[model samples]
Target: MKMTRIFVAALAALGLSGIAWASTAGQREAEHFHWHNAGPFGTFDREAVQRGLQIYQEVCSSCHSLDLIHFRNLGEAGGPFESAEFPNANDNAIVMQIAAGYMIEDGPDDAGDMFERPGVPSDAFPSPFANPQQARGSNGGALPPDLSLIIKARHHGQDYVHSLLLGFNEEVPADVHVAPGKHYNPYFPGGVIAMAPPLFEGSVTYADGTEATMEQMSEDIVTFLTWASDPHMEARKQMGVMVLLYLFIFAILVYIAYRQIWAKVKH
Candidate 1:
């Protein structure tokens, strides 16, 4: 009886907690947008990914860190900077140039002194802040989440991120009480977000002459992030297609063999 009561109490507590979470987090649904890489055969748009990378470097890198990515990854198969001539990403001239642009801290020298040097292709993208405390200090006590795997981390991630970027409302609703630092974003949990609207018209001039509209920027960034999160998506999809084709052929052969053998025997 005591065990049953304990379990019942636990269930009730969990139910209440779920209800509370729903009250806070379930306010709005993210609007779905068409993504180039949505279906099994869909592939990342190279131009969009490249544009997204530029946006990240110019704007988002100041706050968020892409710890999982290395400069060399940019030149790998299916990456935005990938080239047919350069199979080895480390040797890719474009990747090397991009890496050299960053100042990376190197190991202690023979004199036991740490020093900064030009980054190499193998080096990971540097964090904007030295530590978590510094990150929070810079962003009004809110730590900017690392965006490396954000797409996989969040539910309805692509839609959620796209929506969040454009969700900020200039006019606050009367029913909503937004704190000083927080901005009104109905799409965000609790209808408020610490981060302000990051994108605006003409935020970054596109190299390929694409117009720098907010929606275009958002879509581009999301595409880039999706690629960042799943670099092998295209390869995986291709492999899946091959596997399905192989299985289909094998099944047909097996059926033919079975029919051939059964022909000699009475059903």
Candidate 2:
């Protein structure tokens, strides 16, 4: 059939493309992100997420932005944003800063200016770049992609990122030619991405009294990134339940309808 031929052609195309990526992506499974205890890996850890957010604010925010993520998402990780503002610099000064652009004032009137300055709310996280060009220039023209949805894009994302951070540099075969400013990594979309390893051994200090080893820090950051990308995990789960319930109900109705229509016309 025509449809069968089309399906075969599509499969062939997919195979060729995947092969091309394999040559370029050169990504390995062991050294890149492979979390032993995260949602996709094992289970979600609320405490690890909380710590990851703290680390993100202090360190990674300088380089990355969770523009699609809102300030309120912190609630899922046991941080309900105690105050009305974000990244609050002080107890009294409410104008919280972000890696992205400054927060534009927007809220209900008669709320009576709770803080000295306006804040970024849970509905939004600002973009650091004025535009895409500026963003590319800032990061050696690599164009730091918005990380708010990175977890969804990455393969075994949490694990891959964690592994990369834990010094999972790749071995370029002696015959392969690697251009300058490009690092060979098996975990990147292109086996040779411009992104150098971001995390290193003992790169951060933990307030939870945990050792700031490469493994711990990488895992923590990945957790935060995952939550940032998918803040509504609980909501999504709820919706899934509703969907399943609706399907069950619909099936029952259809069965009843079928029985009634055929009952009077017994063959």
Candidate 3:
């Protein structure tokens, strides 16, 4: 059929595109990682997400901006700071306090000039620098990518991120050459990364008294990034399960009706 041919052609095109993408993405195999949020029924570990947020705040926020996230997002379900007491992050005392710590550029005043004001929960996470030029200039001419959707944007997603974070060290293969100011990381696409090793055994002191091992930080941050990328993941999965249950019940009813109708007819 014409429809069948069209579907086949579309699939062929997709396959070709995937091949092209794979060829250019990287030569190194992405290391597999197990996460708590990996499957259909999976849910986020709230405490781990909170720790990840803490790590991001203390370390990653200096170089990378979480531009797409707002203070209010931290109060939503599946988020690190989500809670029954503070269901609305916009009005939550903690979120309000965190937001107020930053100074944001705002609207024209009576004199029609731009002014700066303390941030609110409604404001976006502030960028570390004024612009890309500033960001690049400060970081050896390489602009740090935003962390907003980083877990989703990369080829291997969170696994790639986890590997890259733990992959850095002083040792490099004899044949590989790393330029000054850049670090060698085998997990990175080109085996060279702009950012240095950001994680260490004691880089962050967790308020929950959890030991801040390198692996723990990487895993926690990845978990937070995953939640940031898809805040509605839990809701979506729940809805999918409900839909499947409804379909199963409906099919059983339809089958019973079909059997009754057939019984009334002659063979």
Q: How many clashes (backbone N, Cα, C below 3 Å) per candidate?
A: 0, 14, 0
Tens-digit lDDT string for candidate 2 (185-248): 6556546677777766666777678887776777887887876766655454445455555656
TM-score of each: 0.88, 0.63, 0.87
lDDT against the true structure, per candidate, is 0.86, 0.59, 0.82
At residue 157, what lDDT does model 2 achieve?
Answer: 60
Ranking by TM-score: 1, 3, 2
| Candidate achieving higher TM-score, 1 or 2 | 1
Q: What TM-score quantifies how close candidate 1 is to the native fold?
A: 0.88
Candidate 1, pairs of clashing residues: none
Q: Is candidate 1 or candidate 2 better by lDDT?
A: 1
**For residues 1-267, could you state the per-residue lDDT of candidate 1 as single tens digits?**
864564444433222212212323645888889899887668899999999999999999999999999999999998999998899999999899989999998879999999999998999999999999999999999999999999977767788899889888546779889899889988888788999899999999998999999899999999999999988878876766665566568779999999999999985
Which number leads on lDDT?
1
TM-score: the better of candidates 1 and 3: 1
RMSD of every candidate to native, in Å, equals 9.3, 8.9, 5.1
The reply for model 1, stretches above 4 Å from the true place, is 1-24
Residue range with the least summed lDDT across 10 consecutive positions in model 2: 15-24
Query: Sort by lDDT, best first: what order?
Result: 1, 3, 2
